[model samples]
Target: MHIAVILKQVPDLVEEVEVDSQGTDIDRDSVKWKLNEFDDHALEQAVLLKESSGAEVTAVALAADGVDQLLYAAVARGVDRAIRVTTASARTDAPAAAAALAGVLADMGVDLVLTGVQAVDDLHGQLAPILATRLGWPHVSVVSRVSLEGTEAEVTQEYSGGRMATLEVDLPAVLGVQAAPRPPRYVPISRLRQVMASAELGSAAAAAAAPALGSTVTRLAAPPQGQGAQMLEGRPEAVAEQIVALLRERGLVEA
Candidate 1:
């Protein structure tokens, strides 16, 4: 089966982040980018399927600061091909982004599509389902594992409250990868360099992409700094009294 893996580059939270003066979005300056963690898992799954069944795997990403780095990385990890979808802005709206992605998948006529359950930047967890909606295909979310069975797929889905169920799903479907069947295999830097030199990455613009759904941010603000705890080191009785006094001072306890 031919598979398409939707990819995205997200802010690397390991580094410090800043907001722009407008306070409506993150400041792109000085921001480090990486593949969304779950998308890495999805890529791994696609590679695994490619290795075992010789499935043709293609990866697509939206235009962004580090998209070429990401596409080359996918190639180094054994994706058969890579495509970059052009976007008007670095921060494409979620619904509009999904529409563009769905447009790509439909054009490719892929049998199945895989993507991270959610992106770190948005955490909406809606892209794959939206793709399914746009394509009128079956969709599943929070998938932990998948095994192909003679044109059908047996999938293990995880739910909150420690619940899980395995389902038999038909093809031409979308899966939101909650966890990869295995930890993503690392591609060597040398291999990435080799792929970058040899691979031909394609680009496309989604003709059907539309304006994003109505959502406006009035302001963006940093969270309040946390207050360090005050340790009351003393006798138990003294500590208890100090706690009560402190509570009283704060009006947490009656004087």
Candidate 2:
């Protein structure tokens, strides 16, 4: 089996984020980058499947600035090969990105493509389904478990209302994995250094040849600040009344 895992490089979750003065994009000068957290789980799942089923796992990424570190990490995590789709802009919009990826996968002839359900930085959670639609393949999102038998895969996914469902999908399918489904394996320092030194990282030509989807960003804004908490003081009955009044005032309770 030839499995392709889509990885994304994102701002380090630990770092402090500040919007650019224009408020159009993040301030890149002070930001640190790392592999997308959920993508790590997707990579781990692909590696585990390779170990168990002797499948060949290839890690692919839409190469943004400062993505070499992420490619090395994927190699250390047990991806047999790595491909980078070099692009000038790190567009966070999922559909445009997926369209570019569809072109790359078309040439690679991948049997299965796995990606994180959502990127921590953007949380779009739409890439996998969009990619599947572009490729005309079956897609399963929010997958918690995946088991392969012969040429078919059984995928267990979480749904609304805490519901769970399983489905069987054939090859040439896309699966969007959630974090809790499988914990990521640690990449030893030794292995990490080895991959950094020896892994073959190349950019596919198709990525450059593909036309831009012409996506536009009208404006960006931060969420409103949270209100200060009120302290209820006095007797138990008085405090309860005050709490109820506050809830009602905030439209959180019926009057």
C-alpha lDDT values of all predictions: 0.85, 0.80
Specify the poorest-scoring 10-residue window by lDDT in model 2. 205-214
State the lDDT of candidate 1 residue by residue for 1-255, as single tens digits. 899998887788999888887887788776888898989999998898898888999999887767989999999999999999986654555577787777778888899899988886663336888888888988898998877777777888998899999998889899989888799998899999999999999998877745555667877777776876878999999999999999999999789
What TM-score would each prediction reach against the true structure? Answer: 0.85, 0.81
Predicted candidate 2 versus true structure: per-residue lDDT over 133-214, tens digit per residue: 9899999988888878988889988989999988999988999988535588888899889888887797884453333556
> What C-alpha lDDT does candidate 1 achieve relative to the native structure?
0.85
Candidate 1 similarity to native, TM-score = 0.85
Which is the leading candidate under TM-score? 1
